[model samples]
Target: MTQFDAGTEFDRQVRTLIEKGFGELAGLSADAYADLLAPLRATVTDRAAGMEAPTEGRVPFVLVITRELAPIERAVPLLTLGGRKRKPGIIDRHYAEGDLVRFVPAKEVELPDARAYVLFDVDRGEEFCGAIPNDAMATIAGRGRTPLTMEEGIALVTQYPAALAKNKCFSLGGSRCGDRRVPAIWISENAPKLGWCWAGNPHTWLGMASAADRAGSLG
Candidate 1:
């Protein structure tokens, strides 16, 4: 089986996301990778490679991330625990219309709407993207969203049409999360045989061209 390190996969994902959703830079560089990794977790295990497990009930949802440029570290932050702080691995792209993906950082409870508590719910895992549950594994960064409750989160979801419409969460080997009708990927020149994914509407802010671009990008 062919195996690229978690960092490399992360680099490809970030580049694809930024390239399709926002940035136009050539791709991620060593310096830029380091910059993105400053506060996130970079596990030494295969979890960085996309093998993950189900972590639903644990308070504070964990998103175990890789630096993508460097193998020396990983990013594990807890977004569901309730705090107002945004961890480094997480980024708020912008306030664009219908472009606010729930994965982007926001205090869902701050709004008066109680039913807006829905988040894109990216899985909290480690060792690999699809690894089974391991009790000893380290949790992602702790409690960055401690300031809110579930009721408010639901309300925000109802109020923010953009975020709700764009809230397409993903999980490898998990159930399909996005609109099935939407085309889902980009062909990577670096790894041409392995077509890459560009995913979701909010993620479309990057440079992902549908009309002019090819259909290989898995958006």
Candidate 2:
């Protein structure tokens, strides 16, 4: 994987999002979307100074737009893997639009109300691969960490597609539909896909993704 300076990575994220038509999805012009995120550039630079790149894990931080601004259904389609053509990410047919809305962040995960924020120390928890989603959530909480929500999981992949490696995919255990369904991102036909798995069932290839914490605003 290639590493970039904090400023460069931040710039790349903005450029990538705009190129993917995130602004249009959010009903804003490309220029407006870039301008809206201007305030976050300084925050990324400052926070990045004190943080060291993890030897293993996703990335130091990821820039994320909330579901309110970029709906998961729309945002997932923007993702591509292995440099292939962008494929639309899909929610399981079992879940209607209403079911998607019910899958909020777990109580242990506190998110800010701001439309955009930074998620730090993101990790596609490979160590937990094969563990039940419910058990993984408990372990993550015991370590004082929070599991990644569906939107947050998508945001990580949006910034770093390489994170969704084959045989090493991850689950968004932080978002629960008040039932057994846990959202996950994995490779499907060499493209990134958004789908779900049973919370109580263990999959050898799927780990629960998590983060150390999140910041809603730089201010």
The model with the greatest TM-score is: 2
What is the lDDT for 10 in model 2? 83
- After superposition, candidate 1 runs with Cα above 4 Å error: 1-4, 24-34, 37-219
Candidate lDDT values, in order: 0.23, 0.82
lDDT of 2 at 109: 70
Q: List TM-score per model, in order.
A: 0.22, 0.91
lDDT of 2 by residue, 128-190 (tens): 899999899889989998899988988888878778887789999888877788899888866
